[model samples]
Target: QRLLVTIALEAARVMEEGIVTDPREADVGSILAFGFAPYTGGALSYIDGIGAKLFVKIAKGLQKKYGAEFKAPKLLLDMAEKGETFYERFDPY
Candidate 1:
């Protein structure tokens, strides 16, 4: 879970910096460049597969039990709240 959050946040940060165009590209890069799990369809997909809302909820609990690093980002929270999926928003076919 920590690994998932770390990868998702890192990918988001890179995208926010305008270093990447889409989440899929970022996922691919992270997988190939950083050796992320391809079987899980990269980090973003892994998060999606786990369900962002559930991930954020678990992350929040983990944050309280652990540290701030476990806290989900505002972007993720907002995305989850609106039922807006990361892949749909970031990639959009």
Candidate 2:
């Protein structure tokens, strides 16, 4: 479960930071392009669902509990501290 979540989260980061321009597009692509879990609501949605702060906190725990592979990125840390979601931070509109 944790590994799956981490993969989703990192995929989200890749999209939000550079790959994709729109949050909605990323969410849609995750479903159509990767067949990601619909219930999880794609990577960004999963993070948003948990709240950025909580997501980072959980990722940090996972990092220690599992390995460095689960480490939250700097962007995540910054967003978590500032209470910004990926949509809020990366939305072009």
Candidate 3:
């Protein structure tokens, strides 16, 4: 969904921005700073566990059913299509 995509993108940005390198640290920050469900192990973990491609597909469906905000960003779509994980593309540190 939009929530997952937003988290993933934000996590990616954090990594791209050289804020952190370890995904585990990113997850902790997301949960602590953003309050991203500690039970799910942060946004990146949630997306990775649920599968980015699947999440994007579901999000696209939601976008059609809901509104523009649900629309997955191109970066997400490209990442999903290419099977690229956030950590693979970004290094916060």
Candidate 1, clashing residue pairs?
none
* Candidate 3 residue lDDT tens string, 1-93: 456566765775566556766788889988888878788788777767777798788777876877666666666677788887765655455
Q: Which model scores highest in TM-score?
A: 2
What is the Cα-based TM-score of model 1?
Answer: 0.79
**Candidate 2 segments exceeding 4 Å error:** none
lDDT of 1: 0.74
Residue-level lDDT of model 2, residues 1-93, one tens digit each, is: 685566667676686468766777777677777777788787778787788888887887888988988887777778889998878877658
Best by lDDT: 2
Query: In model 1, which runs have C-alpha deviations exceeding 4 angstroms?
Result: none
Relative to the true structure, how large is the alpha-carbon lDDT of every model?
A: 0.74, 0.76, 0.72
Q: State the TM-score for model 2.
A: 0.81
Residue-level lDDT of model 1, residues 1-93, one tens digit each, is: 567667776776566567876878888987998777788787777667777787778778878987887767777778778776668778747
Ranking by lDDT: 2, 1, 3
**If ranked by TM-score, best first, what sequence of candidates would result?**
2, 1, 3
Find the 10 residues in a row with the least total lDDT in model 3. 84-93
Could you list the CA RMSD of all candidates, in the order they appear?
Answer: 2.0, 2.0, 3.4
Measured on C-alpha atoms, candidate 2 has an lDDT of 0.76
Per-residue lDDT, model 3, residue 17, is 59
